[model samples]
Target: MGPDLWNANYDELLEIPLPKQVQLTGFADDVAATIVADSAEETELLVWSTIDTVEDWLEQHRLKLAKQKTEMVVLTRQKRFPKPFKVDIGETTLTSTRALRYLGVMIDDKLSFREHLESACIRASKTVSSLSRFLTNTIGPRTKKRRVLLEVVHSILLYGAEIWADILKQKTYRRKMAAVQRRGALRVTCAYRTVSEAPVLVIAGAAPIDLLAFERAKLYNAKMNGDNSNEARARLKKETLCEWQNRWTSGEAGRWTERLIPDISVWLSRKHGETDFYLNQLLTGHDQFNAYLFKMSLHPTPTCKYCPDKIDDAEHTFFECDRWKDYRSSTEEIIGARLSPRAW
Candidate 1:
């Protein structure tokens, strides 16, 4: 049947008065009824009576309730469990479940939403792994790969973020979501897996995943309050970037990267260039630089191989080394300014 027909059916269902203490809500053909009472027996009695009223209504409309697709769940926060009960409508018995998938979000007995977040992470991880098989650090189009990660994979992970985004405030949940983003960042930057999360994210020009989720939640709230969508999004983008910059600056990791990219906003605002393998290496300081290799225990010393006196890191290679002077001068001439650690 069409949506208008279903809407009319639901509108008619709303006119049928349910038992006392019971409330009924229908969306399309799915009906959810709730009863709040002091005891299980009273709740069950009210539920049965409510079901009888619903069944009678359905019979008049010649619609049979799908017994196999029906589910019931009891939500409680008590330390001791409530007594078990079966809800029988016609010949079907509905057993209470600890959790149920309503719409798309998973609702648990305790309403913690742990199950839904875990499932989202799993799904995002799988999508990243599958994409990784086809795309590589140097082989694929960097922009498209990043687009897929942000558009496809992120959509999967943040399906119902507006509702559950608050859970990401917990360190455990934040870390789980960050791990998935880390994988995508690795692909985007084409950097080594050894690169830490903050630097990889910066080099990849991706905001922190938790920050993105929080932005989504805030934007949703703003829209509900009658704010303009585009204006709200722009304002939230600035706020999110500020938070990301604060975290990056205050954190202990990615110190070298911080020097190269002091302002994340400038880095992200670049419209033309993509972060290719070489550029990612330069920004993250995770390339074959002697200093990084030495830190990784793959080289004997941190001295530059060409200069043999200065430490060879991203800063030295990009700004100090004489070997790349011509390339640096050419870039400086193109940009009409000299390159310095603080220039960006």
Candidate 2:
């Protein structure tokens, strides 16, 4: 084995890269050239960076070649080849909450598995986002707005669907998770503000909190090492309620934050009386109650020179003002006719 034999044999083949050369003809000639080359140095560096044995190179190269020759040929060129197969992100059946987390987004020159856990979470979150969008578009308008939160929650809960299908089927599983189930329900209920506390017309009719509230609560529960947890739950509860207030105040929902809160107050008045009050309230006078009252209030205007005062809270706008007598009269008439009936 010397350089002459190696050069004479491989000179024609080595002109092109191994991957490209491998396509025109098998790697047999390449292997032979590397074996009979001038020194082990050339063979090691240029030919066999993997190992010394011909058999080792052949075995590995065969698989690599098979992949290159397959559908991956075009993919390899596009840098999309050899995508590691994991759970499909676009598939609705995958439901893994663990995937909602991520370590780092950028990969270094030497890629390691430090980011594996986080990467999994990122992928899962992305999949949930995708599925959520799909479901939102498909489920129709009534429930479409909740697409983001529901998709994420379903993905997290049912992530191991194949494994958990039997567990989910058994009523025994729900019984074991009675604590979690209760907490989940509480998260949903508490994430919403009572009509009385914030009386906004939009929130009067038992408008549910966004699904993010429940998902965040569940995530919080998981972080607590399976001990029943309310830290995430509590944060989410306030976060969602606050979001409603924010949106309403910003005028996205066409109502004044303060004046509109009375409808919410009225709605909450019904719930303060019983356990599962949202349900119990309906059994009595809840259905007849008008949550729509708050939404109909005038949009808050900052430059109301006619408001007679600084134009602050609902009390200032409605009760103590003589400046806007005409506006007040109109309001009185509407209230007397519309809301007074509901109150009595």
Candidate 3:
């Protein structure tokens, strides 16, 4: 089918009423729709009517609904109980599943992102293995290979991550994502998988996926806060960020007196590419004068090249180095940020 014609017809057909509860989430030959109800009976009624409406709409549009491919899956919290009945769609009964792959995300009945995380990890691993030859560490000439790998891997890893929260959630998913990132770093840098991936990531200018996700989530939260059109949305959006931050500060990172989250995501989005690159280096502590590497005896000298008196480490260079102290002071005054917990 031609793109324009198919899209026009599908768009027209999808606007049909599928009951008040069921919502049309996307428009296409393939759509992911949802319906929420209080009870099984109400849900069933809505589902039945939705199917009927879809069928009638298809008929009116002179297009046939593919009964064989059509299937329905209901997500519920009842783990031990079997579905009392099945949803009938023509001759085929729609099958039920513990997990549903919607828009490339695997959402299980529990609303946990575990399945999606696992799926993304698997896809990322396969990409790493399949494209090993492209390693100027994952990309080469003009960043073509790197761009392709990122477009595929990061897209899978961070899909819908804007909705990520910590409450009633597990840290295992973050660990898993970090593990995948470490593996990619090792592969690209040709380091032993067991070795620390920090240096490799820094030298390669690669940002960890978990950090990237965290930054993106913060950006999404900021955007929601700035949106003023709808009251309900604003409240929910604010609540989402507040809940996540509260859980993070109180539960997992309670020891941290100052907020660990920098407004760098917003900065990255608005700033130049070079600035973004530098910020990542700063956050990861993996810039040109990497002190930790010198401690490992990877570099010839640990002393600051600009100021021979002071050790040129991340902390010193970025904060206390004699050479940059003036610059750092001016920067702090301008941004109104001290960049340290004890600096105040």
Candidate 1 has which clashing residue pairs, if any?
none
Which of the two candidates, 1 or 3, achieves a greater TM-score against the reference? Answer: 1
Q: Which order, best to worst by lDDT?
A: 1, 3, 2
Ranking by TM-score: 1, 3, 2
> Can you tell me which runs of candidate 1 are displaced by over 4 Å?
83-85, 333-336
Residue 209 in candidate 2, Cα distance off native in Å = 6.1
Highest lDDT model number: 1
The C-alpha lDDT values of all candidates are: 0.83, 0.35, 0.59
Alpha-carbon shift of residue 289 in model 1 (angstroms): 1.6
- Predicted structure 3: clash tally: 2
lDDT of 2 by residue, 154-217 (tens): 4444343322233333444433332232222222222222223222223323223223334454
In candidate 3 the C-alpha lDDT for residue 249 amounts to 40
lDDT of 2 at 147: 29
Put down candidate 3 lDDT per residue, 1-344, tens digits, no spaces.
Answer: 59888887688655775667778765457766688877776776787787788778878878776767665666677654356446776677776666777767777766776777888788887876665555543234333245445456667677778765341135677777766666665544444343454443432345555556665576667667785546545565455444444443454321221222322233224433322334434434554664646866788887887788777755677767777778888988997988563442
Looking at model 3, the pairs that clash are 135-138, 304-312
CA shift of 317, model 1, Å: 2.1
How large an RMSD does model 1 have? 2.4
Clashes of each: 0, 22, 2
